[model samples]
Target: MQSCSSALCVLILLITTVTTSSGSASLSVTVKLNDSATLPCSERCSGLVTWTVSHKPTDVLAECDQTSCRSVKEGYQMIHDQYLKGNLSLTITDADFTKRDWYTCTCNNKDICDVALQLEPLRSSVQMKPGETLVLDLDVSDPVEVIYNSRANGSSGHICIVDRGSLECTVEYAQRASLTSALELKGVTPSDSGVYTIQVTRTEEVIHVYTVTIQDDLPHPDRDQETVVPVWGIILLILLVVLMGGCFCNVVVLQRRRNIMQRWRKTDGQRKKEKKKEKWLSLT
Candidate 1:
């Protein structure tokens, strides 16, 4: 009876481990956007080996046979040489947010390994002046929560939610917050400077992190003087153009009077000659 009990306990433990391994991912691989990632699964298989995602088990991502290896989907592949050496790793040429999920590898239709492909948070840095708008990319289609940490107060809280391509914000940001592909705040002040984290609402996995710095709207000592110089320069330019135009008009008027006086003098000289001829003819 003791032997039976010990055997039973061992069997139960083995069954538990097998179940957990099949249901959960044994490895977690995180990579940045557009970076290549290799999900390692070293197991020799004489027959065909296949890789599939948990979301769609029927769809194959990569497959390999003893003769050769091929990728069923674009951007995913299994190296032929590596597979021959018992390395059944799935290589993603470009890791993206859309490809993040739990992936499974099978040899001859038997599950051999499970891996979680997670995407690293997209980091962003922003610098803006007071009264300017702030925008942070959500970077995921699924529902997510945006948490804001204030730089001044060193406090943090949920600021917004993204769902079904829409957004909802807290009471403090309700009037100013909007969303499209990203979360936008209409008028941000220095107090609003801080980090904004966008994470999955259900899983709480971070998708995006933004560090925002809002510069203070301090008054410049020469602010008025700087503006006044441009205004004065513009006024002086206008006055100079007007003075040049007046001088041109005065020269035109004087030239026109001089032409009229010359014509009158020529006419008077011709009339005096005609009178002298008439007096000489009358004397004759």
Candidate 2:
């Protein structure tokens, strides 16, 4: 009876170990947008291998066996040549935010592994002046939560939460923000400049991240002085042209008068000479 009890305890321990190992087998991987993600499954099982999204387990993504491998969903594939060697890993081409989720791989109707695919959030940088408005554009299809972290003020918190059909903003600044297409923050000051993170709660992943820098409204040089100088220069140029034209007209008039005076004097002299010749002929 002592030996039998000991055997039963060992059997129970073995079953517990197997259950623990199966439950604890999981992987987390991060991939960038439009890049490829490889879900590793190193099990060398000849049974039917299937991959499915954990959220929707009924939807089969892909399935493979010893004979051939095929994709049940677009953009998902398994390397057929590697299947014989027991590498049942799946390669998803052009990964996007829609593909970010928990993936489960099964062999012969048994869960072999779980892969959590986390996509790196899209990043954008913006610079704006004080009192200007900033906009954040997100490309997620599902609902999301927006978080704001200000480096200048050392403040960090949630700005809003968007549901499938409703949009609600919690912060005062975001309350005035637009919800038509993007998040808009108005009257931004230098203290408002910092990183803004947008997370999708459905996938529990950040989908968009933005780094913003706000600058002081620097006092620009008075353009009135610069503008006045050009106006005065143009006015002075017009006055100088008028003065030169007047002087040229006066000189031309004087030259014409002098010529008229010379012609009158020559005509008088000619008349006097003709009269003197007439008197000399009469006397002869």
lDDT of each: 0.89, 0.84
Tell me the spans in candidate 1 whose CA falls farther than 4 Å from its real position: 1-11, 17-25, 217-284
lDDT of 2 at 110: 85
lDDT of 1 by residue, 1-284 (tens): 99999999999999999988665347889998999999999888999999999667789999999899888899999988998899999999999998889999989988888899998898889887788889888777889999988899899999888899877888999999987677889888888989999999999999989998888755544775666667788999999999999999999999999999999999999999999999999999
Q: Can you write out model 2's per-residue Cα lDDT over 1-284, one digit (the tens) per residue?
A: 99999999999999999888877269888988899999888887788998899878779888889899999999999977888898989889878877878899888878888999878779999887787778887677688888889897788988888777467887576456767677777888888889999888665677889999888754434654555667788999999999999999999999999999999999999999999999999999
Residue 180 in candidate 1, Cα distance off native in Å:
2.0
Backbone clash tally (model 2): 0
For model 1, the local distance difference test gives 0.89
| Number of clashes recorded per candidate | 0, 0
In candidate 1, what residue range of length 10 has the lowest lDDT sum? Answer: 217-226
TM-score of each: 0.71, 0.68
Best by lDDT: 1
Q: Which residue pairs overlap in candidate 2's backbone? A: none
